[model samples]
Target chain A: MKNQWIHIFSGTVKVKLTGKGIERFLNQLTKNGVSIWNVRKHGSEAVTFYVNLQDVKKLRIPARDSNCKIRFLERAGGPFFLSKLWTNSGFFIGACLFLGLIMLLSNMVWGIEIRGANPATEHHIRKELDKMGISVGKMQFSIDNVESVQRELTDKIGALTWIGVELKGTTYHFQVVEKSEPKKAEVIGPRHLIAKRKAAIVKIFVEKGEPVVKVNDYVLPGQLLVSGLYGNEDDMKTVAASGEILGETWYSTKVELPLKSTFQVFNGSEKRKYSLKIAGRTLPVWGFGDPDFKEYETEVNDHPIKFFKWELPLMVEKKTLREREEVTRIYSREEAVESAKELARKDIKNHLPENAIIKGEKILHQSIENDKVKLTTHFTIIEDIAVGQPISQGD
Target chain B: MAKKWGQYVRKWMTQKMDLPQDVMMDLPRITMIGQVHIYIENHRGLLAFSDGEVRLMIKHGQLLVKGKAFVIKTILPEEILLEGKIDQVIYIND
Candidate 1:
């Protein structure tokens, strides 16, 4: 009974009766099991009373010798407020508002979210959705064709193998599977470590295999550092190789340091902006302008809404604008030369083995380049630099 | 002529002969006793009351009332007996 949709129909009734005559009529109607009330006269000769269809059919005249007329108005549909057929304007607007509220409440989504992927992949997928104009605080995403979204995403990011999307209640969920990358096979064949650059052999360690060069030997780029083949001529064994042959390569480097320099440094002040997307067009809710940091740097961060495409959930990109300051200093020629040599030594030291000991160092040349002094250095080292241990399997 | 025909129809409908009563002897009675209002409904002795207090006796049960002056208006089978100025009513189980 509660689930049934009951339609109410109402119609006005006109009756001819005096004040006392109407009272007697209502009393008789009540006595006959016809439940009604609010009976009142609209004019001098007429009285109106509301009655249900069943009771209307059962109505009967009370007096036999009296002169009274009963006329039934046209049947009207809707509630009492809506059944008034006289006026052009009434409570229709309020009724429409009430019905609209019901529809809006039932259609709204309670939750919206992305699912079925790791944070990284999910972030990428969410970004793509933002590009396609999905987002929060907007109308619920009621896309009928989710396959198209999935297809667009897979086409954009090759790492995603498959994807799925669904709507439950008011929430939208995304399911994604990432494609796995294959591993490279190990190199079991014989291979040798050759010189990657033109440098003097400052240190050498020949373990397992024979060394082609000794310490202090000058070597060029592409020269073999570790020999895969061993023994003198006939006794050479064609064996699968293992073990490290550490070789210290030398580098002649020239470095320059200016007496005056200008560098940009960030002061770390930022302003935030918000944006929204609708129908594949992005609209900025906040104004676009330079950050209000005069001495500080500026950065722009943009974050895409997780469940909504056009809605920005957070700021992701930070474009930092750093202000540069000029600094000046004066140095003697000897100081500048020493500083240049120190810089060159430091750069050359990176390519040598950790245990290599610098035996001697000398400045090969010094010159002026641009606004800075350039000094070239030569370094000598002696150390055991072996990379691999001997691997032997008994037959 | 139309008014005369309507009068004849109304008289015929109202003058229908009453049928013999096929009343059910057993009827469920609900009596509500509260701090303020006391309601009593009896099926055999069709009676109901709501006021300050009411004392009633029906079948084997006895009810005691206490409060201001009370009134017992009408009593009929399938009809209600109303009491005014009733505060409370206590019923003793037989």
Candidate 2:
């Protein structure tokens, strides 16, 4: 009873002995360091007792010396229990496989819901998602995170003004905002079209107005180009002046172009490393060691894991390191001057309206300073110069 | 006569040194809890055991216990625990 707990863990055996000198047999067992407890006598020559499972071997010599017949009644305890479990190993493996299948199913993308989008846009978005491997039944780990999905969708679709992506449980939800055209407000009051800038008239077509200025006539700002009053002064009627006036404008710009330029570009050699982020810490999973490239661009993408409807805190992060190299371009003197004039022309074009056309370009002055070509250039452009002015009572 | 004198001397020493009699006289220590259990220590060996009686060899004599449904709860080199309904306890000199 003193070490009964230890005996249960190591195992215990009940043994029965039948002999002439049973007491001598018990004493011999004690002398051999085999502890026995709960001794009960069946008759004058038969006795039963519990002994440590390990001491069953030591009992043979004692039983032989005492000329007794020994029999093991039962064995019980931890070893027997483990052996019983081993006999049913197939059932244990089946339970484990079932649990793994449930986990895999829970992490799959089961459904996709797109809201606030038309049927056409929804179909287009679903196609894009399929191409990106985010369709139904796809494993969530193999797809990009929600933020990247939102960015990619917005970039690919021209009609979407804004889109929101949310991952809930095994489904992906998309909230879309389509880009709609704004309504225009027209000005129909009696007005006059005046020159908003100083320019020579190139072409003019008056509609519902009287022509006040002719082609090739130079006019100043606020000068009338089209008048809303028509007919004789006795029967004059007022109406809105609406017409297109093409004007030729001049622009002078100063630009400097470097003779030599150096920039970095990707060399197409990339290394990918995958790691797991747990509790805000990164643990490298696949790739080991730092990349050897000195100049490289790093791009990290995180895909959070999900367990049923709950988002797990752990994430799989993929880091891509792309090697880049510096490139240098040297321009000749003539080439630099030409590029400077082109740069000035592009600058003026950006400032003008969409319908403006560049008529001519000329380099008025050119100089070289510190390996850069500087020039002053004049550009000729044709654009609309008329702006509506509401008729005042005094006018 | 010599054994009797030895016992007398040991008893006088026990009284003078305030020593327990069981230790000084080399006698088995027997403890009983009502009539259900008995614990014996400082015994030489188990002489015999049965459901009705238990016998142990002490230093100078054989200690016997008569009980109904007797069970040897524990047995070691120097100790024995007995569980049953005790009827009598006696000692037999060789």
Candidate 3:
């Protein structure tokens, strides 16, 4: 290590001396305290030696006194290499020009892409964007106001609901969401309100139609509850019906619940497995053996390694397997009855409309057989049962 | 007779002064590392260097080194380090 530094700092040079007096010349240099090494002799006349740059100039008198001809072979060191590089300027200029060209080319927008849009919609947006001076081959820094261009596109075309502009590498990526217009409502000319369900009438209110059925009347389905036309038959006027008729209704639901139930309960024993996920591919590093469990559920938790503002493609995933066991428990008669009624209530609740309110609830009948309970529950509901029925063309 | 007596007195002086044998006798202490490196202490000057041979002047004789592609690593006043494939080394009594 020390020898290399000595050679470099001293800046050694190779010299070749030829003639009958080369030995005397070397011996004289040696005696003069000039260190030279690695001497190779050729035919007792020519000799080559490496000496420091400082000592090469001091060899003049010795070479002259010994009558030996001297010639320099090579000069080596950092300074010599730098001097040679400085003499040739064409390579450095070409390299700098190449780098500048690459920088300029990479900063210009080359391709424009529209994502998440249909072709026709994409064409429309592209046209709108082009009119706003956002297009390919433009310099990236020219678009100083991206939101203004987006607003211009929105004002020119009604098809874009939301839009985002992003510049990635040399491509200009545009994200777009198309607009959807609300549908128009249809109007049926004139109609009458009739009984939609078989129930005893609780109350009736005429908002914009004449009442055809009175309160407390048990009406069958399809019967007219309100008339769309008013006045006499000779001077009859047609009108749209609008009214509300509340009916006291009854609903029955049948349920069967078993006295013994089997359930899967987690046993609190868990095993964890680790894996390294790279680009959506998982490679297991340890724990290759299978988990000791009969029935289990796997829950995966992952922690992704992120750098700065970007989430890297690598992650560590831990999978935990929770062991489970099937546990059966016998239910009492009263518990079975309670469960059956709850089941019936839930079933009836699903069938009722939004406006129907449960005024009364009770279990009417319940019977147990073969380790099971069968029950029927009744619910009293009050709701607006008036439905629209259009009049015939004869009217 | 005087020269033989001088040699005896020099040996007795070396032992009395507790000096190293190579330094007292001015002999070349040659060391080698495998066949790739060789170091010679107490060398005087270079005699010849070729592709397959190297010769140097020691105190008592000329040291000949047979090798392939020999190159001198470094040289100081007291020691010279040589590197390459060294096959054999011999001392010429001349």
Q: Pick the candidate with the highest lDDT.
A: 2
Fnat for every candidate? 0.00, 0.81, 0.27
**For each candidate, what TM-score against the reference?**
0.35, 0.72, 0.47
* Per-candidate iRMSD: 13.0, 1.4, 3.7
**Runs in model 1 with CA error above 4 Å?**
A1-187, A190-204, A210-236, A241-249, A269-298, A306-342, A349-360, A367-370, A381-395, B1-94
Question: Candidate 2 overall Cα lDDT vs. reference?
Answer: 0.89
The lDDT per prediction is 0.53, 0.89, 0.79
Model 2 is docked with a DockQ of 0.64
Q: Candidate 3's residue-wise lDDT over A77-170, tens digit each? A: 7667677788777899888988667655665668888887888888888887676667788755445345666677677778888878765666
Evaluation by lDDT, superior candidate among 2 and 3: 2
lDDT of 1 at A153: 77
Q: In candidate 3, residue A222 scores what lDDT? A: 92
- Residues A1-395 of candidate 2 have per-residue lDDT tens digits of 38567778888888988888999888877777788998999978899999988888999887777778999998888797678789987899999998678778888999999999989999999999999999999988788889999999999998899999998888899999987735577758999999998899999988879889999999899999999888897987888998999999888888989999999999998898999999899999988887888899998988777666666788889999999899998999988887887789788877999999989888899999999998998888898999998887576
Q: Write the per-residue lDDT of candidate 1 for residues A1-395, one digit (tens) a residue.
A: 11112324443232334443543454455456654432344544555544554556556555433345455553434544453533535566667787666545434444447666778887887787767756553344233235666778789977788877775544667777777635577655555556655656655544445567776676666776676676778776644344443345444666778855566554444465555655446577765876555665544443333332223333223344555343456667777877777777778778766766676777787777676787778776554443332233331
Give the DockQ-based CAPRI class for model 1.
incorrect
Local error of candidate 2 at A62, Å? 3.8
Candidate 2: residue pairs that collide: none
lDDT comparing candidate 3 with the true structure: 0.79
Q: What's model 1's overall lDDT?
A: 0.53
Per-residue error (Å), model 2, residue A127: 3.9
